[model samples]
Target chain A: MSGTALTQQRDLFARLVTLGEEVTDALDHTNVVSTLGEEELNRAIAAIGDRALPDAATSALAALAASVERVIAANDPHRAIDWIGMQPRLALTLLAATLNPASLPKDVVPPSSGATVAARIPAGISFSDAPRDGRAVVYSGIQADPILRPLAVAIANATPAERLIARAVMNDPEPTAAEAAALFAALPSHRTTTDPLVVGALAIGGKAQASNAQYRGAVVEATTAEMLRRRPVLANDADRLVRRERRFAIDGVSADPHPFDVTVEAGPVPELWDCKWGARGIDASLLAELEDARIRAAGSSARIAIGVVAFDTAAIVAARLTIVRAPREKTRFITLETLGRLAAG
Target chain B: MARAVSTPPDAAHPARRPARFATRGHDAAAAHLATLLADAPPHALLIVGPRGAGAGTLARDAVATLMCGEPVDGGPCGACRACRLIASGSHTDLVVINPTGESNTIKIDQIRALAAGFALFSVEGGRRIALIEHADLMNEDAQNALLKTLEEPPSRTHVILAAAEDSRLMPTIRSRCAVIRLGLPDAKQASELLGERLGVDAPTAVRLLRMSSGRPGPLIDAEATGDAARAHAQIRRQILDFAATQPHARLGQLGALVADARAILVAGDDDGNAADGTESDDSSDDAPDVDAEPKKKSPAKRSAKPTPAERRAAATALLRLWRGVARDLALVSTGAVDQIAFPEDRAEIEAVAHRLPPATWGEALHAIDKTLSALRRNGNPELLLDAAALSWPTL
Candidate 1:
């Protein structure tokens, strides 16, 4: 493409992004937009036509636009609710179309075929199950696409840590025991683990890391683990066994078992730590989760100490205030430093 | 008989004797409230306005009128025992609720307690008033808890809610209350009021009034308002400076811009919270005592290291400022310089506007807005800022 054409394409992309943001905002709140007009929606629909997007993507955009226009015309009180229902799918389609327009199929693929392929792939590859080669085989299939070739090359040139994360996200086979151990050991000190390529790979393949919220949760988990390992007193606790992705049935916590990010089984009382990434993350849900855990632990003779490890001091403070109504003697709010001290004792 | 000395009306001491409800440019609202007080007032009244629009003042004035033992022109006879008690914040029949703690939210427990208080008869055998400031900050459960009170308020009791952003209130809660919307005050009147309140000269008052978008409430704290005005001016200059630099140079200065923005936010918060005195809940025992280490430095020095929320708030504020600049640039470019927010910096803004097309300013505006939304949703601040920087038009 010529320079002017590329610039035009970029401008269009930015407009689409803005439209997406406005829609998302409107969906988030009822009164964000006093009047939901179709001017922007129409412009976005026209812009999508101008792009070389796949038929499915184009149809999806058109449908979303039509739905929004219909809602606007109806002047429905639940217009925000309708928008909320439709925005995520619209956003996902826009994201895919914008990210790699060249890779999109000229001919629409069957949904069942796609689902079958997805099913054939493993659910997830555990840290111990990653391939030793550290090659992201998932990219091999898409390397032929002109738009993604540069991204593939970028991944090829990424650091070993990034490659290992990318490989794990791609559901590749297990790495050798030594290689897995080395990579796991290096994760605490790895500065570039959140590289764009690695994050992109995780977004594409890891269900848990699909959204920004979940991605931040993962990053916070890593940081918490790193901080825990950095403290010698906590790290050298012979009685302590730290594990992630541990699910426990704490009676009324939930109908199903609750999954904790990090569970430390030390002495008679186990410690359940849930990592809230930011101030926004420390919300009502966190309180409910912590409260449930506390109630469950109490029911079981107060055998577990509920802890929340949050990075933001304001978030920790907010969470503490939010849960002050409950009996919180066994529940502790912790930063990484405080968590280390508590463990040391 | 010796004449009693009467102090001059002051914004800080709003509850002084002879409560005049002297807000300028709100004559219609005052009249409406007076009419309500003259007869049966609404069981629940919602006073809605943007930040610094004086919703709190209006609410207080209305409450004082309802609780006043002696009425003067449909306002409080501030010399009465009841008025004196209200002024001292010791009125048994008047209860005020504010968002508590670092959470800056009115939780359900507070609302429940308020409800329990409503069950009692008024101490004065008169109307009992519950005033909730920043009612928009009430969480979902709190709002829900308030819905009951709003729906069936007790006999001889009034519930007044003052919200900067009333849209955040639940529809059920909003529906029950008689809504009184406060728009931006008349500019000329606002400037005059600000001049009298801040004891500033005409030009300075007008400038400060423009900075506050014609809100008189924000001018009560002359020092904090001045600090905010200076910070805004600095941010405008930074934007102009950034625009003057090459694209690559602009990218290089991003870190400095972010740091400066964060510092300005910290300073603003420190000054604003202190000046307002509404956020006293931060010192409550309910505050998280996890970080028990005492820091004996000034608040500014201690808060220099901001939490993640603070950082996000700073970035959001910076982007908002950038959006304003972009808007000003657009206005200037379109020969609508009179509509620009930062009138004092018109020449500098025009200089940059001359360098860029109107389309570029529009694009920057949209980019900043998009980044703002993303930042609110907890997007990585640095990455979002980087993306926004790339979209910024360079001179």
Candidate 2:
């Protein structure tokens, strides 16, 4: 934490808070908060965080906190702590930093000290570490399940190379030069101080973003095309379903208002996918939005749970990363490795 | 050119590509790739499968499709010169880093070299495709170096990691690339494909397919490796006899057998000169004549102990042999006789299966697996084998 880094981080926090406030106020005008239950508010907040908002703003932060406060009308002390347990600590810190204590869920106080900011969800994990101050994010929880234990350890004790790899895989937006140097130095040969991010961008032609978009498109189309090539599963399934990039409007006939990145409506529920590649890859926001979509589409006769398919694993990791957002137990997260598993399922 | 005629005239055929991956169980993968490339393939791929699963072939095919001017049939149309170069592995645009020989470890330098090459423009005016075979062998640094390329590869570049064990790869590496795991073909599909491709009869095809766990790659390429298989079969029989020996005598016999085996295979080379030789000679004098060696009179002067490499290879081969035999017993016990790797040993296998219950074979398999695990962790070969001999079930 250099002084400059601190300033930049604070600026980022401020900007994020301002954005959240604008969104929150818009929702308030529509009286969406009045209709939302605590679970839904939590889901909405998770979605907003997924958009990569980290910095904060004063007025907007309070306003956003106020909007959510209306949904959970409690002054109970334990209630606030419980609410804080599931909340994205960093975003909530920024939002609540300026709010009157009453606006926060009953007993919850934002992480400004040694509070258990990040709670361990599994009943057995006894993690209780909070950030020492407003400027840090501490991870103290451990997953106790046998299957996940190894993965948790591996993640916790990730080598520098692994960290670099994770950052790259996630397409983390702000990979430092130090990471590049560390990555290069860690390798047995061809050690250099040159940035690896540059190396990545150049591995594919300057057209990676464009290329991935194509890959994303292909995954959607080719899976369908392969099915078509094999023959129709049911007669005229293709005729009944149309792929919609737009969200299916409330009026039910808009060309462009689909809640997802790609949607195909051939089956009982339209297969909704939110495709992304990069560091901010899979986050609380997308899962939150997808969760919201799943909730909204529950009443539709031909609705499917919004499925997430990431070309990059970072998003999947993010989806699993329970520290920031609540673990999306219900959402289906798909990656390249699990393609066969999904197909079989 | 008269080269292109069916229902329509063709300029180039897909067969012009250097290698063709025609596996039955992986037809769906191949077809899916074709469909993906029926438009444009993804820039990075993590191909997961066991060795000899046509991982390399699929990678090449994908590259060929990407770099070809007028790609056809999910691959490069062969009629073009680029396709021919791709087939011949002479195309400048295609770079394959095979971690074989002294370069068993794909180090960071190799990836750096690749990154440098990728940093430049493509020579063939098409996508630059780099195939990393046995990518799981890459040292951690190499994988890290490769991260950059994986994240945002060069312009018109496609990087494919052909890995045997996906778990060996960093999850980040696994995450960055799209993974496609190739399945082993069923016995019937393998038999059909082996018969069709190699023109082998149903019985031979079945045996080959069974030996390869229903994967046709090894069977298709069997002609090249047939001698080694035969040689190892003989070696296995010797090891099995040693295993059947009384426990008290096993260690002494094992030491003598290895020395004799090494001497016979290495042409009595006293100088450990052939330690790193890739191929062990198929022919070896079976006589265990430790007394016959001229240097036997002077224990201090005996200069012909196997080199570390030879010793390691021998240990590995022994473990493999034990595993193979134990596997046959287990398979027979399970009544999966058709899945036996050594179809020719049916009589002996049946006898073993009948003489001992499936539990005996199961115990043997478990012991063998444990021994192999210890050996992998750099256990002293002689000591480990001695322990294994006592613990292993007698046929």
Candidate 3:
């Protein structure tokens, strides 16, 4: 290991010793010797290394060790383990950095930016390389890192969701941006990223505001569709009933509606278009609106033709669509041939 | 087999002997007497069966033979004065107890009066004949009152009791007397009887004979009264209507009629009401016979109620109507007839019936029988009725 890694490991060990001392003193003496014997205590001490310790950490560890020994001698080893287990603040400090690798400072600097602290660490000195050392670093880092301390506090207090997140972080790799977004969406909190690290990353990506904005837009669109679907005058056609383009000003002037994400040729033909994504095809109601549009375009030099468009994440494709006029009504149904052509495009 | 005891001279012989039942041939009646009546004799005869099964005719035949002064072969000599009086229904000694005011049962008063006649010594120094048309209807008290007379019957007495079934009477009452069970006649016999005896047309005779369910009397009654076709039609309509409404009612009607036949079966030997007396009280004389036989007193048997049997017969009649409906529906479905499906409720019955398979009609008939049986067992009549009505299988 490098000199800096050794120094870090040593520092983590000193802190763990202080924490163990605090836990030991807080407990009775018999347990300290009998259940968490000298060898186990040494192991726990070694595992924690130089993690951070609180003010009464050293004396508390000594007292707690003594108590664990008493409990074991009294034929209650589980009590000794439980008594020590109750020191969650100490435990969280021990695990936070080691278990949650993402919380570590990014070693690789961003391209075209200054050198990063993460780049200084050698490649693949994996989190498990120094398990004993890693725990101490986690404990110390949690105490030192302002952003991680509250999470550590939550873990120490045993909040259910925080505990779940801790356990998940312990067992799995750090979440990606998309996964983080899903997590934030599921969480009941309305506040934005509280952690400076998460806030900085989100601001850099310009994603925090965009995600919330998209959610609102989706909600509004869904609500409008639901309202239209419920209206008897709409005849169960959500698309035909909701014409968002008809927004009017107090002057009774309305903005001309540009076809949504489409281009039209002025070939003496008025064009109608329907768009959907992933080739899922257009709603049946949209075809009816196109039929009405065709009628409105009649008696002009413009000969109207209906258009169907299918879209993927990349780009949209357009195709000529065949409309089956209603036998009774003037509305029409777009044929499957039209849908196929759009998908091919 | 017991020989056919001749009627004494005092008893008048009808000019025409009573008609015979199919089940109770002359031989069985004689044998029944040999087995049951030989122990304690009877002075009067009672006859009972379904109306046209000829209980009256059978009684007349037996009485005339017994009172003919001299009988030829086991039959009466028609030319005798006794025969003439009995045939004319004017014989004083040959008494009959029929229901009063179209009542289905022979009341205890009627039976008691008949007993008075049996108590009197015969004026002609011979057997005094009394025939009861319906014997099983005697309630427990009436049957009990008649016990002593049946146990130690008078001398110079020859009784012939006829019925359609032996089950209607108490076993105690049944044990005391000879039993003659009458059954439906064969088609040819019924036809011949209807045409030759009643002077009905061939077609009418054939229809009446078949519709009479093999009882010549119903046929004769129908012919004489000129209401055979009409009564049959009315019964069919009633059955059809009631089949849809009250399943147990039909069965109760049938059971009541059958019970009446059974009741009268035990009375033929005790009273002359079975022949032509119309209303007589001989049932009181038989009541004591039932009470005295404590061993035979069935606690399970309540008053001899024929309602269940009558209801069952009525249900059977309903089934018969369903059979007609099934035939008509089948004909219509197969293009064999252009007539309305159910002439009474043609529009609706046709609509529903046409949607059902032909076999559903048969199922409906079977369901009616089941419902009848269920009702007789004291099951919920409404449930059975609904089940029977809906039992028609779908097409």
Candidate 2, residues B1-395, lDDT tens digits: the string is 01111121123322222234333556666766665555446677766654544666666667767777886655667768887897676999778885534546778888999999998887777778888877888889998999888877766788877766767788777777766776554557667776787676777666545444444554454331233334445555655564355443454356555654443232212111111111112121121111111122122333565555567456655565567777777889889999766767777777667665676677677666655555444444554564465445444
Q: How accurate locally is residue B38 in candidate 2, as Cα lDDT from 0 to 100?
A: 56
> DockQ for each candidate?
0.03, 0.01, 0.01
Candidate 3 docking class:
incorrect
Clashing pairs in 1: A129-A174, A130-A173, A130-A174, A130-A175, A131-A173, A131-A175, A132-A175
> All models: lDDT?
0.52, 0.46, 0.37
Report the lDDT tens digits of candidate 3 across residue range A19-132. 444454323322322222232233334434575543233322332233333333434332333223222222222232233322211111111322221122122111111123
Q: Which stretches of candidate 3 lie over 4 Å from their true place?
A: A1-345, B1-51, B100-103, B224-319, B323-362, B370-394
Candidate 3 deviation (Cα RMSD): 36.4
State the lDDT of candidate 2 residue by residue for A79-160, as single tens digits.
2222221223222333332222122211111113222222222221111222234322111111111222222222223322
- Candidate 1 lDDT, B205-302, residue by residue in tens: 66666554465554453232455556667877888777765433454466567676654443233212211111211221111110111112223553
Please give the range of 10 consecutive residues that has the lowest summed lDDT in model 3 chain B: B286-295
| Docking category of candidate 2 | incorrect
Superposition TM-score, candidate 2 onto the true structure = 0.42
Can you tell me which runs of candidate 1 are displaced by over 4 Å?
A1-345, B1-19, B196-199, B219-222, B225-227, B262-302
Q: Is candidate 1 or candidate 2 better by lDDT?
A: 1
